[model samples]
Target: MPYCPPDCSCNLDGTVDCGGVDLKEFPRNLSESILHLSLQNNALEVIPMEELSRLQNLETFNLQNNRLTSKGLPDDAFCSLENLLYLYLANNKLTVAPKYLPKTLVSADVAANYLTKIYPLTFGQKPNLRSIYLHNNKLTDAGLPDHMFNGSDGVGILIMSSNFLKYVPKNLPKELFRLHLKDNKLEKIPKGAFDHLSKLRELYLHNNYITNDGIDNETFWKLSSLEYLDLSSNNLTQIPRGLPRNIVLLHLEKNAIKSIPGSWLTQIKNLEYLLLHNNKIKAKAIHPLAFKGLKKLHTFHLYNNMLERIPSGLPRRVKTLMLLHNQITEISRNDFAYSYFLIELNLSYNKLTSPKIHPEAFRKMRLLESLDFSGNNLNVVPSGLPKNLHVLRLKENEINSIPDGSLSGMTKLKELFLSNNKLKLNSIYPGAWKQLTNLQLLDLSGNQLSYVPTDLPESLEYIYLQNNQISVISENAFESTPNIKGIFLRDNRLTTSRVKEIAFEKLKFLQVLDMGAYSESATESKKDGGTSGDNLENDSEQATQNDK
Candidate 1:
């Protein structure tokens, strides 16, 4: 009995759920073993094809969103669904591309629509057509068709991103494996445009105004199973020289790459994740054996760029080396003397100074673990850093001092950022941070401190002596830490009688005691000394008993 079709729902196996039921047509009598026919979100301008040619086993035909145009579709209007296998006309107002379809169709989603020209055997010799979503629409490049992708079609996922293609769309189909031409107005890629694609593997030409004179130094040299290549932003001023040497993720961030010609990492020796940050790279235009054969290069992003130094033969199996900012002023004992697999080293800002570093500059980083050397023009703290350091960002530099065994071989130090810098309070020498035993977050904020610089590390949990010149706190100060938890002392020079009543009672995991404006003049001097307020009522009852 399944002949439903009118604002439909007849599902006893015959399947005919007319989606968004306001269907403005094409829903008569319906059931001829109609194998799924959902006229999605309807106002179907046309495509009745004689009420879908009496549905002879129509294998899934969903007219998505709909306002169907292209003069309401007539030529071969799906040649009567001859066992059609999935054809979703996405969005709709189709300006073409809805012809005969059925070469045993296996997925053809005419995405968005108003498709500006694409009529040459519309997906020729469809070898079981494998996924084709013509993204967005207004396709250009003369509306596409230079053999429209041959090799007898077995199209393996081809999403023509955005559109208005300026080049690179000629006879693509080498059974393409994920080729999304992003944005689009592709300013050129015509060098045998991937002749014989070799099962191309993920190639998204980012942004697109591709330069280097429209690319062709053997254009990716026949993509030998290329692996993930996103030419970021575009207008590249180089670095696109026969890429695919089994490329493993190579995204040229931003672009306009100034120089790095060591045969581009000896022709991508299995390169592993190399994103050239920002770009316009400099440091004498890079070539000191340009990263001597990457050897599985691990995360190397040259932040910002115009590098003035530190590009001295990098890749000692680099493990995250992002040169932040640039103009790096010296660290010279052979720069990073054959890196030794460095583990995170970001020379923040740059122009680093303390006698231009060389005291065995980081004596071959014994697996460094996070070091930023913030802002730079450093006053100290750079003998040979890497004691397996765990995050040591010398903030805004000009570091006034902290010398005696400066952070003595960091014993796995955990987060220590000498803030703003130009430090004081005897510039910290007494047992400096007693070898940080895993110190947890300590930023002597905005420096020039007057106190609180004692041998902190009892695995302290978050301490940023905000602003500085801290008035006083000597009741055994933080009584040699009790896992102090967040004590910022905001905008320092604290008052409440120079803070003493068991100054934060051994910080029982004290939570956020930021007294920035010193508790508003100690609660207005507690209404001008109410209970004979000596020592500002014992520093406001020891900061309300160490914040309960």
Candidate 2:
């Protein structure tokens, strides 16, 4: 009953059911009443503007993902829809826009197209136009006169991500709320580029050619409502001076940031969710009280950084902490003596000999539900863990053995991750994982295990055992784990036949059988179905090393 894609003007105004269909041209049955029409992912060579001219009541139009290289719309094609609001024409092989359209149009999204440049005085008369998405285009302000976007006040969103913008355009509108210019070729953002966006809130300029030397005085003095600012994926080796005090989320990941400049964020009290991951910041150089007054901070991620050890004391009010992919050797005493309401901790991808835990280290943490200690060299886990630990990720480690009662204090443990650990012994302590009745996911990739132990929880849903030296998987290896959704046994020396087929039939909820470390083709297997799997983390790793 409900099937229409976005960027189409329907009377009901719902953007759905419009993707990758084999339509020759625009739909004629709904042409008149359609407010938004999208002929995307179709074999239509001609856009058939005459069909659109008949639609007087249409308000929105989307012609993306089509073979319309010739962006020639009749001058009066949209003269009927005087009350039109939004328009999207992305991925249409467009080079230059028609420069003629309705006057009442508000939001225009032309991203992922071939828009090379904009003509002077083009779209300057559209007073009500706001929220222009021009990302993934070849736009450049090099030849145009400065002072672009000078008077567009009613604008709200300007997504110019992945363009050739060398510097911030001059004379920006003050009413802008969200401006995304990430993955561009911007070398610098002149002080005047942000001079007028006083009411701006979210500015995304990540993956640019910018550095801290480009930041000038009054860097962020106007934007008081600025909350989510992403300066990550840049060439910034230092934090800019004089940021707005009201910023809540600052993403500085994947940069050449070596040390945070003092007095840069000295007095921001409302700041929360500071992501300094994938940088080259040393552990000792980071100030413990740098987040001193941010009591409301709930999430602080510093994974994939250049820290050799955990910072001794951080802000006491942190809830979620991520410290993966660092060079951490061991957890010293009083390493985390500050967190009072700590909920989640991730210490994966390090060189720890063992997951050493100190007494009362997590005693004050009450709501912790997740912990990722994967990709480390831990031989064993220390005693005295928190009681309510739900998820324990210790994958890709060098664990040889775990003594009896190693997880005794962890009574309410739900998931115990021991993937990629060295298990040489055949007999595990009775009831070693008995307390973990609610265990779910267990990944044992890249290990020297000969056989899977029979002590896993029954509530396990997902299991990964690829890239191991396992030669046999007994029928009782997963005897009681009926809720298992997926099991991986590929790329191993499985001497037994009928394992993959047998495991799938036994596990009622079997969905996937990831084997051999997920071949490179399986990268884009996600819910969104987009083939561009996140290469951001890898890029961030290289950026961190480059900055250091």
Best by TM-score: 2
* Tens-digit lDDT track of model 2 for 1-548: 33343444333653333556677666654535455555567766665666666666766676677766544554345566676777777777767655555667788777887777654333445678887778888878763345445345677887888888887766666678998888888888776667677789899988888887777757777677888889998888887777788889989999988875445666667888888998998888787556666787888888888888888557678888988888888776667766667889988777776545564566666677777767776777655466778777766666777677767767566567665577653434667655567767655555666666567778777666655666565666777787876666555554324243354457667665443222223332222232222221122222111011
Span of 10 residues, lowest total lDDT, candidate 2: 539-548
Q: 337 in model 2: Cα distance from truth in Å?
A: 1.2
Report the lDDT tens digits of candidate 1 across residue range 293-312: 66998888988888888888
Candidate 1 structure, TM-score to reference: 0.34
Score candidate 1 by lDDT.
0.78
Clashes of 1: 0
Which portions of model 1 miss their true places by more than 4 Å?
A: 1-170, 173-178, 181-202, 205-261, 264-380, 383-401, 404-548
Query: What is the lDDT for 154 in model 2?
Result: 78
Which residue pairs collide, candidate 1? none
